[model samples]
Target: MSRRDIVTAIPTSFHADGSLDIEGSRAIFRYVAQSGNEGAFVLGTTGEFPAIDEDEFRALVAAALEDLGGRMRVIVHVGRSSAFEAVRRVEIARELGAREFAALTPYYLASAEGAVESYFEAVSEAVGDGSLFVYVYPKRSGIEVSPALLARLAKLPNVIGAKISEMSLDDIAAYRSVVDDDFVLYTGADRDLVAAGEVGAQGVVSGVSSVLPKPFRALAAAADSGDSETIASAQAAVDDVVRIIGGDMPRMKAALRSMGVADGRSRMALVEPDDEALAEIDRVIAAYR
Candidate 1:
């Protein structure tokens, strides 16, 4: 645990023509590696994963592994709503030196009673990577991974952890009751990091941490040491920054741009923020900077 558990859900950098910005992506990876983050979860929601092509995904994976130089962990999000495609990305990422992998239940299909478990077993067993963290994102995947399912998956030798997106602390407590202390849990929601730490979340797979890695690490440190005042202060700062970015992915891009880290262009489907939102993001980023 400690700060070694902080995982940044790093955003994929993109150019204006909607292509992969390899160096920009490298900048993100470099930032995390230097800022004390222990892991990078690429190609997740903030990365606009659904909008990128397979070739671009491959490039990003290579960039992460190469840049990190084994200094930190890189967990690639290989889920594609198709087991075959997800497995394909896992194979590709493994070929590029990605050691850890993560995935979610099929997004567009109705998984059978045991289909979810079967799908993950197939992928993890196929890749045979060091560890696998199943992503629990009901909103995007449209599939729910019940606590029973999670408990079962915890038994899988290679299935070491999970990236829980929206579970409340109570839900996390329920998961703890089922799985062992060795089963690591990461909160995908930054706003809940402090409470999650109190409820046994080992780390965070945070989108905001891509911009504010230092404070995120501080929050984890305080939580680890039971410093309630520091946790409250750290969470307030993160919440202020999150509110400024709101739900706009592009604002996250702009936040990075404020730090001179990215071009701020996502995929073709995503656009930059409006003048109002852009101004707000800059103002808040200035405060953090």
Candidate 2:
């Protein structure tokens, strides 16, 4: 894989009782590796980050590192609204042998550009060593991290780059324009994978790809090969998968279950797929297959 490539935001597999499934960590990693892409972003929104507790959080990252430690680059998301929690999570991941890390813009309180920058600055300072990827998700974070802020933060020795989850091509381009050509700007939205790549996005951090990594993996190949047609077709296929799976992770787990991978379960109170949704998920598997 090129440095500019795809890395999935893998789902945190859980058992029926809503506990962290350690074995499932290796299971998910094997699936991603077989899909032809290396690297992953664990415990992001797709992994139900805020929903899972600290102990559960630590166990999952430990499991991912133990499973994919030497084989693939694992960048774990260690950001919550609380700066203290983010610091604690980073410390734990680093200790577990997690090599790279990423963080969402802080939530539940102030999310202004400066406030969010301050939150990441503190996180980088907390780590005080390794580089970190700042996750830019305005919808959940409740604030947009502007390109200017990203550029400023990227100047920090520990702030390597960012994972821009938003979908503005101009915004992504703006980020690329400021940072070094090699600066990592990972795309979070799968629909814009090709376009974002065109704008110099270095890699992808996708949620939908977790259920089925093959298509996104292929899309990444097309992007790397500069095959526009294949990229478009793969994007269309992923959009179809997204349409079937929707944003509901329980439904994504359902689709993964159909593929004989994940166990098709989620945390407490997460809505399961309705009959129509299940049927659509089945359609996605069969069509994609």
- What digit string (tens of lDDT, one per residue) describes model 1 on residues 1-289? 4433777777778787776788888887887778777778888887788887889888888888888756778888888888888889988888888778888778877676488888888787866846888888887777888889999988876888888887678877787778888788988877777777668777778887778766677677777777778778877887887687644577778888878887757774656788998788787777775
Candidate 2 per-residue C-alpha lDDT over 1-289 given as tens digits, one digit per residue, 9 for 90 to 100? 4455667778778888887776765587677656555677888888889887888888888877776666677888898887888999998888877758888878877656777777887899876667799888887778677778888888876888788876588889998988987688888877666777778887777777777766776766776777778778877887887677745788877877888886747875778889988898888888775
lDDT of 1: 0.79
> What global local distance difference test value does model 2 have?
0.78
Off by over 4 Å in 2: 1-3, 224-228
Residue ranges of candidate 1 with Cα displaced over 4 Å: 1-4
Worst 10 residues of 2 by lDDT: 29-38
What residue pairs are clashing in model 1?
Answer: none
Candidate 1 has a TM-score of 0.92
Error of 1 at 170 (Å): 2.1
